[model samples]
Target: MSMDFKIENVLSMNGGQTDSSYARNSCYQEISLRILQPYLEESIGQMKMVPCGRFCIADLGCAAGPNTLHVAQIICRAVQKKYKALGIGMPDLQVFFSDLPCNDFNLLFQSLPLSVPPDGRLQACHYFAAGVAGSFHNRLFPRSSLHFIHSSFSLHWLSRVPPEVENQMSSSWNGDRVYISKEGRVEVAEAYLRQFQEDLKSFLRARAEEVVEGGWMFLFFSGRAGACPRQQGGSGAVGDILELAFKDMVCEGVIERATRDSFNLPFFSPSALEVRELVEEDGSFLVKKMEFLSMDTEMKIQSDVDFGRMVAKQFRAILEVLIASYFGEHVVESLFQRFAERASQNASVLYNSLRQGGGILAIIERACTP
Candidate 1:
């Protein structure tokens, strides 16, 4: 792994059902999933057949939260609809929720409904659920295992920050910034792009070996609408505002400049073109639907305060553990509080940036051959 960020050891969403946990803050993810419903149903409808007796579905990077089960439930519903429309019985489902080993499977499983409902109302479709702990960058299942695979708001996270970005001796060194920014060096962006390409290539290769031919894969993750990663502000705006927060702490001597410089997040938001090129290069999957979606525009922010708090809480749920690991838990709450205040002041700009740095939904079908 590059730097101190290890995919298996360091990456995981904030667990539990607390006010600050990922479960509460994942409304944004739910919106993305809602947007995905039509396409998911379409994919299922197009699939004229599924495995004979049991259908295996895996939700990769299924972080701890209701969203995790929400994704599975959506797929099960779609599958049920498809079977009902075909006038055939739906196959038994073996759903796997896969995430990093550090994830809270306990919370995820506990969130499942009672096995035997007191109301005696049976679920429309029953699924045998299991949690698979591992990184999706590698193979998590046996050969030709998964019949349908879905991942939402994941995949942009690299297995690690590019090694060169952390080396002061390297030209790509990203000093005092967590991600690629307008003020950052082009070499730094190039480093991130290379890492993203490498990680994506590995991801496709692994999934190719695991998914059966003709199975479907749906992926939704952050992306840039522009052709060039440097052309638009996308996720860079978040990095910029976050750097501002860190600078505030630095000025107060709460953290050293070197401490901030040494820290970097393992994230990259790719362009739609970049994703298509990578998928075509991999040659294992045929793109069925690939489009850039603006998730922020769909959100209804009543006021600047609400927008600020929403953005701050959304990011805190994702970055709280990583930031606390690097900067200590003492500063976590104050840092995010300052972030919310700063975000409120720049609500308009932040909204536009987030819209530009929207999400990408790609529905691809496994080809007959790699």
Candidate 2:
């Protein structure tokens, strides 16, 4: 089903550090960040600073949480380390935390550590910080103004669901599923792939204008191991489970069957080859390093119920707003409750699936001028 892709109005993580907030349930995201840290440091070491003794870094899709500023701190320290090794004065850092205006920038900023000395005496690095609210698919910064860009687990979100998927008469119509799955039609999967391609091209074009020549971008997103959507596995286990929950709601008459049929998720997981080809096709960035890495959960679950609840919370933190916006706020808790029950019952299988799951990390550099 199709809905308005009004990201600024509908998309955001569950805010604050409350029990269900993204900040508390983002352990998996934190794990991904750690996996990418080494790559970030290496990229910083190779960066050619923009003139005038300043460095600008933007973390796109920086949802509200400890992970938001956590990225900034890692980046600042890496740049600092590079400068120290070169025996040069470190440039003033300007960090931008960007996301849709609906993001909880208030909580993100409030959680930032107290100011440290500008001289790098009290910490590894220190600099200015600000928030920019807008879709990264559009131009968000001045032309050639940024030195580095980082977007984690954000690129998978399409600008909107493909229009064809919403038209009931269209061959690409995605009926009864929130995302692509093993049972999905070939035409529907192709529609999603095409949308991802267009959205990715827009993202590259915008960043090409904003980032300085020779700047770097380190990106991470959920992806399939194979080139096509249906290969490897399918959309994802979590997405499948979520769909079943919606089905259960429909069976119980809580939501009409048409309602379930009309709500499609605006997300796509591309393969690494797909990402590389898209970047090369755009003719801006040179792919530096591309690899797949798995995110291991830190929590030790004592039982199936605990594991199920943990998984449910993670999805809720990231997806509650999007789901609630389409299905109504009252249905949100009940949906996740159904989700938890199913997940707990299949805990062992889910755990094994998660252990085998991984994502793509693409480190690309803005090609230098001739």
Candidate 3:
């Protein structure tokens, strides 16, 4: 299916090198590892009794860069350690890193470190990077081939901005272009839910084909509180601060209200129940674990200054891509001016506000089916 939106560009923007933010923000990777470790252990335990054969692990929605591979390396090392303890021979393993066609796979491939030896002989770790453009739900990997499937900080992105929001049929947007209208709010929430449902189905189907019958799948994502989107906070405190910044831009006429409204970022954070329903509906996977934490745990905002800077950097990156993609290259200066003006005041207060907004994480396993 053709994507109505430029998902690859947005993903690139989201994945830009924000070393401080990623390092400081433990929620995405740290918490994800916590949930993933057990499954890895269990999968490795099962692999120990089996005959030496090829083992496959896939990182879906792996952005075109080192960050994706960085995680893969960690998992590989963990699995290797497990086998070492069990005194079982290490299985030949392959790591498949996947993302969209527009992603910089060449850059990712070029940056991979040279192969090292796990034994006296060369390590049998094979790296393959492929682009699975459209929706990841459709086709990700071959059926019954994946031993483990891991995705973190990626699933929340909707396949497309809800059609209702695009048509302006919903009242979510205020005259100021901020999403203040109740109808607009509901519309955005519904759109996200619908997109998530479709995406989840595709994800399950694809994984069902790729993963071995008893293999494991772990997914960690940002989720909202409560059943409805309105019940939750913004995209952490930083996102709220950005919204405030956008408001100022609108008031000063630095950016058109419609321009802001036309910009769509579709992210959904489902509650535990919502996630359970989504997984169970597929009847192919079982919910092994699920956890929801506030923004503090998810994003790891230790201080107001750090929080402010993190939010600022993310907005700056997002704005850079949005300007290049939607408006033309020339409008970046004006956009930066608007961002600067909005972020200059009461940084501490804005940071505190963002800390109040948190996110969620989840883990699942493929149930052995007859």
Candidate 4:
């Protein structure tokens, strides 16, 4: 770990607030899954050739929420239906829901479905859900253990911010900026890029060891459709624009100027090409499908209601913990309140940027020959 690194227990999502559970804001994730439903079915289809006596599936980065089980159920159903169609006895199923250690495992465990109906062609499937506490940047299971791995709305988060950018003592500090954006200087962007490269390699290497040959991995996360993620503003890439909210608070005296300068999110938005290049070089997994999924941004906003608040809550559920760890909970709430106001006023910019934002869906298979 870098001496300047501040990633760990400090960063976590809001633990399912009454109004802002991950479930509510995860519509983008849900839709991302649905869009890749066909590819998911295809990945499950691989079991026909690979022996699956005990199928193990993992939903990596599964925050505690109403939507986490939905992914697990999909995996269970797919595996069950595949086995049933072949007139073979289904294998025992183990589903791992993984996330950072501070995540609300209690909430996630509490929300699991008591049962799941058959999917595709099975009668019924029984799945045992295990809450895995660890960062996906490191290994969490035995080698060749996982069969189908799925992660959504995650993985864009680097295990830590770039040491160069955060270590102010060094000449590589990102200055006052907290994330990659137009505001970030060249070195700042370079620091983020370096961190992303290192973290991504670790993640791919770790997953490569755990997944058996012919096992499939499905990853869905926000990404820039453009070639350069460093420049900011990609489809579904509203991450950078959120900095405006921070600026608003700073100017309004709601937060200290130094506070905003020190805060930097560990998030990184990778372009499809970046991921492709790394996976290709990893020599562990073969890319089966990689494409961008568009989000639904055409919803008609009621003139009376604040549309910005609606969107801010979604991000708040995912980001509040990280922000609160540094600035405290009170500050977190105040910041978002101001964010909601600004976001609503700039809704037109958001809507226009929607076309530039989209989710990357990648289906990869552990090389059978490897």
lDDT of 2 by residue, 180-226 (tens): 87677888889989999999999999999998888899899887777
lDDT of 4 by residue, 286-366 (tens): 988887666654544674136787777877877877777777778877778876776787787775665346667888888
Clashes of each: 0, 1, 14, 6
The model with the greater TM-score, 2 or 4, is: 2
TM-score of each: 0.93, 0.94, 0.78, 0.89
What lDDT does the true structure give each of the candidates?
A: 0.83, 0.83, 0.59, 0.74
lDDT of 1 by residue, 94-150 (tens): 899999987889998888863746664446766888989998899899999888999
CA shift of 300, model 3, Å:
9.7
Candidate 3, 1-370: lDDT as tens digits: 1145565445544332454223233333455455455655555455423445666788776754545666777677766766677777777667877765655566567767746566534363334334455457567666777777778767876665555565555553323323312234575566667777887788788777777766777676767556666444444333444566666667787667777767655566667677778778888876666666554534556664555555555555534554456655665656555444555455665554445544455556667777
**Rank list by lDDT:** 1, 2, 4, 3
CA RMSD per model (angstroms): 2.5, 2.1, 4.5, 3.4
What TM-score quantifies how close candidate 3 is to the native fold?
A: 0.78
TM-score quality measure for candidate 4 = 0.89
Q: How far is candidate 4 from the true structure (C-alpha RMSD, Å)?
A: 3.4
Global lDDT for candidate 2? 0.83
Name model 3 segments beyond 4 Å from true: 1-10, 14-49, 64-66, 85-87, 116-121, 124-134, 171-184, 234-239, 251-254, 294-307, 340-359
